[model samples]
Target chain A: MPIARGYAATDASKPLTPFTFERRNPNPDDVVIDIKFAGICHSDIHTVRNEWKNAVYPIVPGHEIAGIVSAVGSDVTKFKVGDRVGVGCFVDSCIGCAERDLDREQYMPGLAGTYNDFEADRKTRTQGGYSDSIVVREGYVMSIPDNLPLDASAPLLCAGITLYSPLRHWNAGPGKKVAIVGMGGLGHMGVKLGAAMGADITVLSQSLSKKEDGLKLGAKEYYATNDPETFTKLAGTFDLIICTVSAEIDWNAYLGLLKVDGSFVVVGAPENPIPVHAFSIIPGRKSISGSMIGSIKETQEMLDFCGEHNIVSEIEKINIQQVNEAYERVLKSDVRYRFVIDIASLAA
Target chain B: MPIARGYAATDASKPLTPFTFERRNPNPDDVVIDIKFAGICHSDIHTVRNEWKNAVYPIVPGHEIAGIVSAVGSDVTKFKVGDRVGVGCFVDSCIGCAERDLDREQYMPGLAGTYNDFEADRKTRTQGGYSDSIVVREGYVMSIPDNLPLDASAPLLCAGITLYSPLRHWNAGPGKKVAIVGMGGLGHMGVKLGAAMGADITVLSQSLSKKEDGLKLGAKEYYATNDPETFTKLAGTFDLIICTVSAEIDWNAYLGLLKVDGSFVVVGAPENPIPVHAFSIIPGRKSISGSMIGSIKETQEMLDFCGEHNIVSEIEKINIQQVNEAYERVLKSDVRYRFVIDIASLAA
Candidate 1:
């Protein structure tokens, strides 16, 4: 067993602090990763605070992971000691299920979360990417493209794939119009990815504050949703509207923005139930759907796509010691887009 | 102008009474139909009583119409005198739009409802098929198959096409497991259409009171939604669930019955907004969608399909004088399936 140093949430009300734990001894199919960077996602904050009411005590919370392979088992053939790799929201799934066999393991019944969950044995607890190092099944690890830097690429493991899967599933490409509902971490990635896919992209943010960044990042238009005219001007405009904000808003008004037979997809998990009128979708033959993170295979494809398009999250790098402050800023919507933690600070 | 005799709703609180109106003179592209049967739909009750708040006084509310062509304009090519015919929810749409050009006129703007709405000129009040005769453009009329009787085939114009459109749009066929919620007029049609399309069909009704009827109407299984065990047993069981009940129920519970990537479509209109938890659809990548009645082309396809399969609504025929009583029974769900008004009673 190898000693792993990381920040752990020991209590729901307290800040994360340094803790040391033992990593599992490598299995024949496992690869050991020396974590280089970990992005701070909103879900990490929720798990640490027990807001979802399912967190395990002393949970190590980080899923957007980018790192270098420190070691590999004898049977592992996909990576060498120096290969760049990443781990996303899940670490393992039921091996023989149809979803797993089709490379769509994210939706499998027996999926094991990277953290706050038990492994296949149901006894061994699983930790996540907040650590200095991690041991993952070779099948769950994705190879990072060489052109993308580790720090900026971390969020792609989660946010990038969240937007990519829906875009591809709904056939967003040339001649299709896509609208991203927020300008935060997940939504910014949607703009870049949708634009790279050749679709005309728009950002529907709360105000005109992020209009410049949105345009620079690939959105062709930016509108202030707070303005009443925005709704009227964009009525029946988009082929797809990807809602990335968890905050409650008028979902029916947004549904009105979609073209006939268009879809409204939700990536963010809102706390309250969404109140949608049956007439909202019925008149246009529209749909309101949901998407989770992508599978292990799709994540790889997303990373490859990002590499080809030179797309990465606009991030602010922070040390492990500043994580609590970063969380507060995240709550206030103060981060530029994302916050990535440099793992080298774990030693300090 | 030709004098048309029909029952009309003069006030919101009063019972319908006999009324005489004038029909537009035939144009070069017109067909004059002598209505034989008009099916009683819940929408008719809503409109006449002003439940939807958009009723036009003296409105003759019937869209599920079956008739015979008494005369055809010089330019009519599809039908001759004495040819069987039918008319559905709409009479005209904006010409040259993409939706109309694609034969999907139901979703096009400027759609002229068959009743309680104005004609293309926006001045002529378009009365529906409860009358003895109706004058319509040839493009808006459909030719009924010779084998199917006019009375039983009446509801196919509305109830039949409502379910058929979603079944085809969602690819419900062999290997697909479908659930039709509510076993009323709309849902019963769904069971027949889905089974006829080769999909495994189930009925999820409030109680098992209609279980035998559901099973006899092409459903492979029936379950009482009031039973807690039904939800647990059928979790993730359906590829598609078409909700036809306008009453409020737990939508999240039904969303749980869908398999990964499955859809729950709505053709019924609930007065209040449905409250759905985001988690219900997020985990399985499921969707909640809506479908209206079929387009002119698809409605014709549905009728032709029903004809080939020997399918027709199980209807209780009533004379025109009993329509007011039929409306009361319909509100109580007392009819076996549907109520078809015999137009000959108007002359008697």
Candidate 2:
């Protein structure tokens, strides 16, 4: 067994503290990653608070992982010692699930989560990258671009692909109009990607708090959805609308803003049900849909797309000890975009 | 002006009565159709009772018009005297307006309705095909194939296209699993067209009342949605579902029946909002959207497709005098499928 040290919340209402755990010894297909940075995502907070009832206790909640390969097993050919890498939401999956194509291995059917989850055997609890190091299968590990700093690149594992997968799937490109709802960590990536994809991008935020930032990120327009004019002015306008917020929204009203055969894709994970109206989808042939995180192949493609377009998330760096404080700030929407933990601080 | 005769409901509470009205003379681009068969859609009943308040009364509520081209204006090249013709939901749109494509004119903004509507001048109330004759633009009128009977083909104008557009748009074809959520008039058409398009069709009806009928009409399976086994047995199975009934349904429950990236297309007009859970769309990338009646171009294709497949609505033919009784029977879903009034009965 390999010992690892990380911060975790033992209870739903508690703050993070030091926790000791053991990782399995390197299998021939595994690579031990010295996690350089871990992003403090909203899901981390959700898992720590046990908002999802299935959350395991002593939960080491971190999924957005950015790191370097310190060691690789004999059979791991995808990465080598000193190679930069990142591990996203899941660390293992059924590579041959029928739903997946031959080129890409299907994930999440029996795949182990980075934290608070079990492997296929369901006995050993899988810890995550809030720790100083993580061991992942090479097939699940992806190469990080050289230009994107490790700290700033952590959120890309989760937020970046969450936005990119839907936009690309829906064909966001020249002559298309795209709207990014909410200006939080996920929304910001959608704005950057939508703009980089050559779409006429607009921001539909709660208010105009990030109007200037959105335009600076290449958005042509930004509107406060709280304002009545937003709905009237942009009615039947957008070809694609990507929602990144997790709170409950008026889905029917939001769907009303779509054009004929338009789609409103949700990356948001609200706790409640999404209420809809038949007329909302009927008149213009609009649709409301949801997307989860990307597959390994698409995640690599997203990173490549970002690297080619010079699109990187605006990240705020923090020490591992400040993670609980960062979570508090995130709840208040205080971070510039994302908070990435410097794992070196854990060692210190 | 030309005097036209039809049945009209003067008030919401009153039964339809024989009424005489006047229509403008055929314009340069108009084709005067001597209405032969007018299909009684559930919507017509809803409109006469003011269930759909948007209806403009002293309403002559008929849209599924199949007739002979009694006369054509000087510029009319598409239809001539003695040609079989049909007029669907909308008669005149902003003809040359920017909202319309010259090829696909129905998508045009400020689209005009077929009947129970105002003309471009916004004052003259337009009467529909329940009358002895109707004058529509050459662009809006479609040619009915000579092989199909007029009464059987009447519902294809609205009910057929209503299902066909969504099925085609969503790519319902070989290897696709489709479900039609009602076994009434529109749902039956969905089953037929979906089968014609080469998809495995399933009918999700309230009970097994129409099971054998559905199978005869090209459905591979018929299940009572009222049974709990139906949900459990077919969870996450469909690629496209055309909801053709006008009642409010469990949007979330229906959404669960879809596979990843699957869409639940709404053609039925519901009186209330359907509550949805974001979770349904989020986890599997599912969608819920609505569709209106098809464009004139697509309607022609639907007519041609039905002709090729030898498919037509199962209809009960009645004289104009029985239109009131047909309305009552439609409310009970007592008719086999559709009730098409023989327009020639109006002359007697």
Q: Estimate each model's TM-score.
A: 0.99, 0.97
**Tens-place lDDT digits, model 1, residues A171-249:** 9999999999999999999999999999999999999999999999999999999999999999999999999999999
Lowest lDDT 10-residue stretch of candidate 2 chain A: A100-109
Relative to the real complex, the DockQ score for model 2 comes to 0.73
Question: Which candidate should be chosen as best, given lDDT against the real structure?
Answer: 1
Residue-wise C-alpha lDDT for candidate 2, range B140-239, written one tens digit per residue: 8998988899899999998888899889989999999999999988999999999999999999999998899999999999999889899989998999
True contacts kept of 2: 0.89
Candidate 2 residue B14 C-alpha distance from true site, Å: 1.0
Per-prediction DockQ scores?
0.91, 0.73
How well is each residue in B1-348 modelled by candidate 1, as lDDT tens digits?
A: 999999999999999999999999999889999999999999999999999899879899899999999999999999899999999998888978988877677987799999999987888999987889999888889978888989999999999999999999999999999999999999999999999999999999999999999999899999999999999999989999999999999899999999999999999999999887999988988999999998998999999999999889989999999999999999898887999999999999
Clashing pairs in 1: none
- TM-score of chain A, every prediction, order shown: 0.99, 0.97
lDDT of 2 by residue, A1-348 (tens): 888999988999999999988888888999999999998889899888988887778988889999999999999988999988999988877767765563233223565777888865578788888998888888889999988778888899999999998999899999999999999899999999989999999999999988999999989999998898889888888999998887777777788788787999988788887667777888877888888888888999999888888777899988999988899999999988999899999877
For residue B172, model 2's alpha carbon misses the true position, in angstroms, by 1.5
